[model samples]
Target: MRMIEIEKEQENPKMNNLRNFYERALQEFGTSDEDLWLQYIQEELGPWGQPENCGKIHWRAMKFLEGQSAESFTSKHALFQSGRL
Candidate 1:
């Protein structure tokens, strides 16, 4: 997972495009199907996604994501909180 500035959670041009792409991808994959929700969250929290909009992603993921995907996100978040991510 990559690190991103967690201040305010805004967006930029690159982030907008990435968001759009992810939305289309999620739509195609039916959201809960085969996916890369974690990667999306990482990108949203990375350099491309300027201000970081991962909070929304995290909440959505916890609700929609299942199995190992859900567990992975939980673990990553925990590591992040502990500054070990």
Candidate 2:
């Protein structure tokens, strides 16, 4: 546990930069952008995947996506939660 803490305290520079990049990009262009939200969600579902992180992003997305996009994301979320994704 101590080693894990130490490693996290020394986050990889490249990954740190990538996280910063995502923050800036989202701030500038992710508003009402379903595709960008989807991309960020997918990124969160990558190797560093965390359920809470994905949930937060998905909730945020619900505030933006509409019509067909919202429907699609909703269906996808249902499938994912049902283990049919």
Candidate 3:
């Protein structure tokens, strides 16, 4: 079994591209074990799983969309942020 961590996330364009590639690969080559998929993503991206990475991506996107800086964003209050939740 694996454990996932929730932390202040950051977005990577490369990661998004990789996810799209993976989606296409899955459609073309068929599916594989989820654990294997996670392992592959971890190796290619980082320690966090895809969902967590995506969350980080969303956070960064939101920050950009709102014209906010990292210093202006509150990690602890993210869920309560008007446009974030």
RMSD of each: 7.3, 8.1, 13.8
The list of candidate 3 runs beyond 4 A from truth reads 1-13, 32-36, 39-85
The local lDDT score (0 to 100) that residue 78 gets in candidate 2 is 74
Q: Total clashing residue pairs per candidate?
A: 0, 0, 0
Q: Would you list the C-alpha lDDT of every candidate in the order shown?
A: 0.61, 0.62, 0.38
Tens digits of per-residue lDDT for model 2, 1-85? 2332343456452434444556566676555456666656665665654545777888877876767777777777777668786
Worst 10 residues of 3 by lDDT: 1-10
Instruction: State in Å the error of residue 28, model 2.
Output: 7.2
Candidate 3 per-residue lDDT, tens place, 1-85, comes to 1111111133433544455555454344323233323333343445433544645544433433232333233332353334453
Candidate 1 clashing pairs, residues 3+ apart or interchain: none
- The model with the greatest TM-score is 1
Cα deviation of 78, candidate 3, in Å: 32
**Lowest-scoring 10 consecutive residues by lDDT in candidate 2?**
1-10
Which rank order by TM-score, best down to worst? Answer: 1, 2, 3
lDDT-superior candidate, 2 or 3: 2
Model 1: residues >4 Å from true position, as ranges? 1-13, 29-35, 50-52, 80-85
TM-score of each: 0.57, 0.53, 0.29
